[model samples]
Structures are given as structure tokens and as C-alpha cells.
Target: MKLTTCFSTVRTRMVSSQPKYELIQEVGRGSYGVVYEAVVKRTRARVAVKKIRCHSPENVELALREFWALSSIQSQHPNVIHLEECILQRDHLAQRMNHGSSSPLYLELVETSLKGEISFDPCCAYYLWFVTDFCDGGDMNAYLLSRKPSRKTNTSFMLQLGSALAFLHRNQIIHRDLKPDNILISQACTPAGSCEPTLKVADFGLSKVCSTSGLNPEEPASVNKCFLSTACGTDFYMAPEVWEGHYTAKADIFALGVIIWAMVERITFVDVETQKELLGSYVQQGSEIVPLGEALLENPKMELLIPARKKSMNSHMKQLIREMLSANPQERPDAFELELRLVRIACRELDWDT
Candidate 1:
């Protein structure tokens, strides 16, 4: 079982000498650093603090990038991580003597990470860190692995995820990594037993801001010119062009498609070995994906997903997934279009007003 719950009762463990916040315990770890739960001394508001040991120049740059990525999108959308502030708390006297400086990030507290990465331990944790809102629902990956969600719950999650991604794409931000691990769930208690699960897209470490100023002045200065050339992100969801070093927002759409497919079908398409094989193929043969529909053929796990697709998929949702995972990035619908499509499907499937 994932580590979650028990954080509220833990005694305060100060990660830094900063008097304003008190640490509760370690909660989760992101792509680059460790995360902890903290309390604001004045208001006693709980928050998640991320700690990074800045030992080198590259580490320093990564810390800044993560800070700015979350900070830049602050208050921009309800579904993004809220960065409270950043701080530089000196490490231990011994460690500080050797390292020379401190680096910690502060953020608003949510319930839990989408992956349920919190376990209330009584022991206090002391580490240099940053803070952000805590997410209660853990992460999408854990939730799906635990159990298949109710149709109603799935609708709510898809709506929030699509809306959040739409908001980001509109702001010209590419969330290079949109896996289940990065999508958090916020469950609100409502009269209907609970308000729909609200998903917060976190871990912007791989995200990039699209800009077009570097191109030749003679050419058009379109923001779309800001193409990413890195072949990053988890394999199962990677788009074809990502391997070729030329991709855009549509690349994210491809990832979203894979995510939604796994979400509804309750299956993990490619295994770790397959991921390595495909990555090797791309590195050696310059080919990323096999072909459309080849996903079911290539991954044995698709046996379950194939049946689920036939039984549960309606025309609209199926069409959307297929289009999003198309071989041609241009053929994929942008986030806005995907959101609209999901909204319509949700309204029809859930019989709720749009």
C-alpha cells in the first residue's frame, strides 16, 4: 500500500531554521528532490515543502527551473500547483560548512499527492526545502492501481484533467511530462457524498515555456515555432515526433490520449522491457512507434484493454483517443479541442448539464 495518512498528528520538525514554518514529516518526492509536510507558524496552515540538495551547478539550475515552472503558473489556474514562496535555509552546520549555501522551496498545502505519498509518522523530519499545496488523493497512478474508478468518478477526473491541460496549453506552457504520477486528485466532501475529484497537475520539472524570439527575424514570429527537441517523458505515452526531436503542444495531446486510454481501460500497455526496446529502436533505427493500432498488437497487456475498449468505449471517447494518438502530430486535436470533446462526452455519459 502507498504511504498516506498519519501526517496530521506528527510533531513539528523544522526543515530549516526559518521560524515561520514547522515541518511535519516527509510526504513525497518529485523528479528532482524530496518533499515534506510543513505547518505555517502563524496560521498553522499545512503545506508540502520540497527539499533539494544543491551540490552542483546543474542541480542549482534544475532547482530554479522547477521553482519557476510552478511559480510562473501560480494563480493562473485552479488545477495547477500553488507555490507559496521560496527560501534558502542553511543546511546542518557540518553540511553547510562544506556546501556553502541553502536552497528550499515553499508551497501551499493540499490534501495529498495523487499517488497517496503521505503516511502520518510521529517522528519529525528535518531537511532543507520548499513548500506547495498538498494533494490528498495521492496520484492517478496509485488510484488506478488500487481500483477501477466508478464511471461517475472517471468522468469527473477526465473533465478536470482536460480543463487543466487546456488552461496550460492556452498559456503556451508545454507540460512535457503528463503521466499519472504528475496528476493529483483533490477529493472534496459534498452533499452528494463528495464533490467530483479535482485533479491538480503538478511536477512541472519537465515543462517548458514556448517562445519564438530566437528564430530569424525574416521569418514569422509565431509561438508555435517554439518546438521542443528532447526525447523525454515515460515511454508508453511518448509521441512519435518526440523521438525525432521536433514536437509541439500536440505531443502533450498524444500523452493525454495514452493516459486516458489507460484510465478507462485499466491497463498498462507497455512494460519496462518494451520501453527499453522501443527506446533502443529510436536510438538505433530512428523510429519511435511501430504504427497506429500496433499498440494493442505489440503489448501483451492490451488483451484486457481490448475487451474493455469494445465494452465501455463509446464513439466519441474512442474517436478522441484515436485522434489524439495519431501518428501525425498535426492531426491531433489541441488541448482546447480535447477538453471540449471530453466535456460533451461527460455531459452525455453522466447525463449532467454542461
Candidate 2:
């Protein structure tokens, strides 16, 4: 069967004119919506359903924007969370029935099955639903927190993250929110079902699409000239330009740098007091300008310094990371360059270790 046909069959099985899918339990919650683990009546497919509460115009707009954005670029890459279908609230059913209709559904339907049996009438009317593949491993934030050391991020994980970011940037989409909480792991691992996880970038609620016309290929500047005046990201991951209301794709790059720092150093951005101190030192002491790489390396015992026992990272990796984290947006490497650099490091790491 064709891929589209398979997806269509899955959608029909998951959603109907009546409410057939049973909400097994709550999976996640956010300011915008509550996610539930639901199962389809016909096909018995298990899925994650995100239902956003539309309290205001802004909330509705955010929901619509996210839906459209995901729809527009669905399944562009394996590293991105795929959108199977979007469920718009059925007003007809809402007005006629006392029970509420599903509104603004973002579904990730996984192919896994639980042992429970669900009984539903074939003739009963059901509300419309969105279907998507369910990722059983859960979000990166939960995974990282579950680790024994709490902050021990491995090298392979970082490489996978970099690859996901590269895919997002290639599509001219900037995931404004690139925190650990937004990355999700797939259920499929290794043969023993225990391997380093593969990550997918989720939550496009804060993402912005770059205009192709004004984008400068040579310069690192994006064509998205519309000043994103509204500050919408987490405080710690917010780039300096983001606070200044002059964000571009570079802002996402900045966040990626913070993520890399977190994975390597096993520290939160807010917890890095020494980074703030060093930047402040540059302002106060009137000292000769110090390179960020040198500054970070100098303070080996500093709480915020990225832990590098022997500075094991190769020169290329260091240089790439430095460029990504550059304070000046103009100096930062674009997404393509960042991807190439990361791929090289990942490949080299594998070669050297072998």
C-alpha cells in the first residue's frame, strides 16, 4: 500500500464522526495544552494526543500557527516529529452534544499496543481526531532527569541532537525553543532495546519560518526581517538578540550552543554564574579582550566551566561550538555550516575511538 493510503487508513481508524478513541491517561501538560495517551477503536493503535485549551485569541493563534507549521513541513526529516493529521474542533457536534469535541489535536501515533481491550459500538457517532506515531521513550527532558548522574550526557546523544537541529534549519524553520524539554526520543532503540536514544525536535509553537527572498546566502543574516518583538522563549535559552527583539535563525543557533554546553558541562544555563561573572569581568576590569574559548578553558575549577578532563574534544569540534555560541550574531555559522562541522566531528570521533 502507498504511504498516504496507510496514513489515511490509520487516521480513519483513530478518528471517526463519534468519539471512539479512549483516553487512557495523561502523558504531558503545558501552558497551551494537555497530552493524553489514547487508543484507536478500530485499529487499536496507541497514540499521544495534545489538546490545547483556547482561552484567548493569542492562544488560538498559537495553536493554529503550530498546526499549520507542522502540517506544512510534516515528515521532512526523521529527526523531526511527524504530524499525521490535524483535528479541528467540530462545532456541529459541540453545539448538539453535551460532551465536548476534540479541539486542536496534535497527534503522535506510535505502533505499540497495550494488553487492555476496548469495547465501542460501530454505529456510535465520534468526534474528529488527529493521528500520529507515538514515541514511547518520552521527551529528552524526562530522559535526562531519569539518568543516575542526572546530567551525564553522552557524545552520541549530542551528535543526534546536532543532526536534528541541522534538519530543522535546512527547512528554513527555527525552533525558537530548543531546550531539553522540547527534544523527544523514539521508542525504537537497539536489539537489546537498550541503546543510545535518537532525538526528534518537537513543539513548533515558537518557531518562525524564514522568507526565501531577502535571505542573504553569503552573510549569516536571515530574511525574516519581521522583528519578533514578543519575547516568547524560556529565559535562560533566550539569545541576547532575542531579548533585544532582533532575533533571526542565529537565535536558534545560540540556543543550540547553550544545549551543547549543557550536555558537555551537565549544567543549566541559569546555573552558570561563572559565565555571567566572566562576561561581567570583561566589562568591569577594562582587560584586554579575551577569547571566549580561552576564558572558558582558563577557569578549570569554575562551576560553570564546561567539564573537559583532557579537553578531549578535537580542535574542529571546539571551533564549531565556539562559532555557534559567538556573542555576535554576524560571526556565528549558519545552520548548514554547523551541520557540516558537527557531522565531521561525529564521524571523526567514531574513527578515532575505533
User: What's each prediction's TM-score?
Assistant: 0.71, 0.68
Q: What is the C-alpha local distance difference test score of each model?
A: 0.60, 0.55
| lDDT leader | 1
lDDT of 2 by residue, 153-187 (tens): 45667667777777776666777877777777876
Q: For model 2, give the 10-residue run with minimal summed lDDT.
A: 108-117
Model 2 misplacement above 4 A? 1-16, 90-131, 148-153, 190-192, 212-227, 269-312, 350-354
Model 2 lDDT, residue 242, Cα: 72
Give the winner by TM-score.
Answer: 1
